[model samples]
Target: MKNILQEVFETLRDFLSVNSPEQSHMLTVYANLDQANPLNRKERPAWLIELKNTFDNLSEEQKNALMTFDGASLTWNGIEEQIISTLEQHEAKGRSVVVFTDLSDTVVIDLPLPVKTGVYYGIPQVKHMLSQLHRYGQYLVVLFSEREHRTVFVDVPTLVSEGTLQSSLGEGIFLRPGGNKTRTQASERRNLDTERRMLREAAGEINDYFMDEPLFDRIVFGGNLKIAHGVKNNLHHAVAEQLVSIEPIPFDATDEQLRETVSILADEYEAVHDLALIQELILRGETCGRAASGMDEVMDALQNGQVRKLYLPYPMDADDFDTLLIEAVLENVEVELVHGIAAETLREMGGVGAALYYVIR
Candidate 1:
């Protein structure tokens, strides 16, 4: 999924770079490919019907411009036939299919996630498509124990473990005689020191691991709480700041159990994060701070490149929302498709808001 998103980003970049005067006639189509009935294989899919209807609805001038644009050889009928042929050749398994063409060059992308189904003529409506393709940041789950410690890298959106690092702390052996009380106390202290040393080393290993691939957005610690906290304190400041939660998972938990624990904690963290963002936006808007709520102010902030983060409700149907999203992406602003309470609050604020870098005033 990450690789697929990277490809989509690259495609978007290429599309944005085109400078031809005839580029205005480019047609981009987004279609939901999920079939409603598996048994009725011969039935025409609903999305295909919608696509045909969209073509039929376009003005004659618009239709002619698309078909007869310079460098474009395919007519409207030829374009539809090619779309059908290409779709037929591929298995109808993905959630959506996106077609981008200047009528000369066509790029079809079969996405794992669903996107808004429609025809976007004149300009490529890519904001919604990119938003759907966006994957949340990765997670680093570290399970610490007295005897063994493990670090599991997780893809937060899918809750799938990418890989793991593990190390065994050697047995706590007392070198001195334990028969005497003083010697026994000293032995216990030495064992504690050994455990702390092992944990510190494990923390160092984690730092090194992420230094090579620093993609994880959040960190979760599990197993022994005391040990986890100790390791957390030992981590680098940058990595330590990413520590979101510490869960009560057993050191010997199965893969499934670990994944479930991480998922639950991650979801909780996200909910809190979303709520906080919404609250900040509300407060800033009321106080006239570096925040903009509602479409007008947010769009103005986005145009000036002052928006640091743009928040929008998922699955918004309005064309204006699409335009705002496109502007946000083109400016390299962080776009978050909020949901639940955050989305509801945003909808009340005209379905969009932004955290700005600075207020123009």
Candidate 2:
């Protein structure tokens, strides 16, 4: 349920806008509340109890806040509908209790994916979530048409309609006739021109998003092939360069159908993204001397905060891999989980590699 992570994410953005105390003697806690973990759901989670005990040593204001907060109440908010799988609450005196949930591990506190969690109010701790989630891959699926731009992130398909853009080229002239065939053909030409114009204008709007760092570097086309292709053809070079593939979904595709379409298209997009990253890593490693391959070199670079990017050929099951992942997050390093030939390439370099802060050249 992540209880609709997007809502939590949006709330976090709004909360960050105001200045709250760094350590306002506020009592903050992150309760996993994973249904599978009973301990987390109990009346008093051990973590919360321990935190409560710690507050007793602080000033009366902190103690009062912690004492008044019904820890179980926090866990049960939206729990009846199974809306919350993981819950995090940030509380302060004279401030409302703020909670965020996600269907996936959006925080590094519990997961090893370089995500971060902080109890301090007014701090944007979600930077870790924002940066790492996209690194794994977040696609900007552009469903192009003359009417509107239906953009979606592959991972979160339901929210596709949110950032959508709308535009119109006015109604196109319809062609019909025998004696007026010449006029009809001209009308047809005009209509197609209008269609093309609308598609390109939509593409330009989509391109504007990337320029502003939508952070979704990969693009997949959806909707009518004719219009989608036209948009692809006319896309600003920046957007065109990142076009991965086209999704087999019509503009009017239903939610269920779009979900299925996204599944297949997402797989293809990942392959494309991984291949592109691998090629870039190799070319840059050789040309710029900024990338390091092999475990020892990568770890050394990570320890020094020189690893601009990290490439793990495949998911490692060993302790060492976990250690590396932990170090990467602590250092705020960018990591990509690669597969297939990309994995093979990294394996050739001792199963790990890093793009560093400096180039030997």
Candidate 3:
């Protein structure tokens, strides 16, 4: 099955493909369904109420445009009813839902990860959607052991297992009964060689799997630290470069345990990743290199198509955050929604930054 990240990418592609004219009216609702009280099913969701208020506040022109977009088939009320009914039926209690409609085609998506919730009643606002997707990118976990090794692909935010690429035992190397010290030493040497050979084979299999399916943003190794490191050493440079961490999980860990371990590791890795990016931005900015910090500089860089990547804090409160995000996405700049200490640091630095393709003199 395709992971949530893959599904989001496909959805984004499809959404962008739909023809949307300048005069077309679009309703984009990003609601945090996870905040709904499951116990109080009778109460209207906060998001629905917010949407109602937003709709009420729209100008007559906007309302008329939306109501008449379907040409007598669907009205504004009908569209609202559909949204309510669809959301009511779906089991999206702990997730965010995005509703995009040009009044002709309506697409609803349930996001496995949480996002900054709001109702955008203009052109489809895909910045938050794309940012969330980037934050919870796809990853691979390789759990190595002496007897067997397993490879599992996971969606980082949801901890949902996409699929297992490999799960097989290696050649067994048993200790031999040696009569003399010389024979015992020889047997030990043979066992070591066999182990190395098994590790090399495992690394080759992993490299091949990555080559065939290269959607993984990060790769982690867990279980049997010795074997994990051994396999890491033998991995091809392309695969090795993506390795984030070698965790100390047991070889016989249950699926739940494995997921939990990887989840924590992924978060830590992301925190470190965010910090490194922020540091890079700061260092480059200091030296007048290819980096821009603060809203104005970042926006200028994005407009110039000089931005290679944009970094913003999660739960951005800045009024221009979405505008910056939209510009970055339109420019095909990589977006990273930072959290934790890095996010705090970014907020201090005007809550937005970008790594540019080149320094602007």
TM-score for each prediction?
Answer: 0.73, 0.55, 0.72
Q: Which stretches of candidate 3 lie over 4 Å from their true place?
A: 1-25, 30-75, 78-97, 104-119, 131-139, 151-154, 160-189, 317-319
Tell how far residue 40 is off in model 3, in angstroms.
17
Ranking, TM-score, top scorer first: 1, 3, 2
Instruction: Please give, for residues 1-361, the per-residue lDDT of candidate 2 as tens digits.
Output: 1223334344443432232313222222333334344564588664454434433345555333433332333332232123223333422221112233221112222321321223322222333343333333456777755445576665433234335544343432112223654476677777667666666666677777766655464677877566678778888987798887775567766666665666666666666677788788888788878888887788888887788878876544344564465456556565667867777777877888777888543
Q: Compose the digit string of candidate 3's lDDT tens values, residues 1-361.
A: 1345446545654664564423335677776677555632537766667657766777777666666654655677886787667666767744688877765567778875666656556556766676565644567887765566666767766665636555343342122334566666667788778777777778888888877775677888887787788889999999998888898867667768777877888888888888988998899888878888888988998888899888888866555675675565455566777888999999898878888889767
Choose 1 or 3, whichever is better by lDDT.
Answer: 1
**Candidate 1: worst-modelled 10 consecutive residues by lDDT:** 169-178
After TM-score superposition, the amount by which residue 157's alpha carbon in candidate 3 deviates from its true location, in angstroms, is 4.5
Please report the candidate that would top TM-score against the real structure.
Answer: 1
Ten-residue segment with the worst summed lDDT in candidate 3? Answer: 167-176
Q: Write the per-residue lDDT of candidate 1 for residues 1-361, one digit (tens) a residue.
A: 4456656656665665563413466677887776654532547766677768877887888777777767656578887787667666666566788877766667677777666667767766766676677655677777766556667766756656546674444442112234566556667787678767766777888787766565567888887787787778889988787788888877777868777777777777777788888998888877878888889989889889899988887657677775675566467677777767877888998889998888887
- Runs in model 2 deviating more than 4 A are 1-136, 144-153, 156-164, 168-180, 184-193, 209-217, 279-290, 303-306, 322-332, 357-361
lDDT leaderboard ranking: 1, 3, 2
lDDT for position 352 in model 3: 88
* Model 1 CA deviation exceeding 4 Å by range: 1-11, 19-24, 29-73, 80-99, 105-122, 157-159, 166-189
- Candidate 1 versus truth, CA RMSD in Å, comes to 5.7
Inter-residue clash pairs, candidate 2:
2-101, 2-102, 2-103, 108-115
Model 1 clash tally, residue pairs = 0
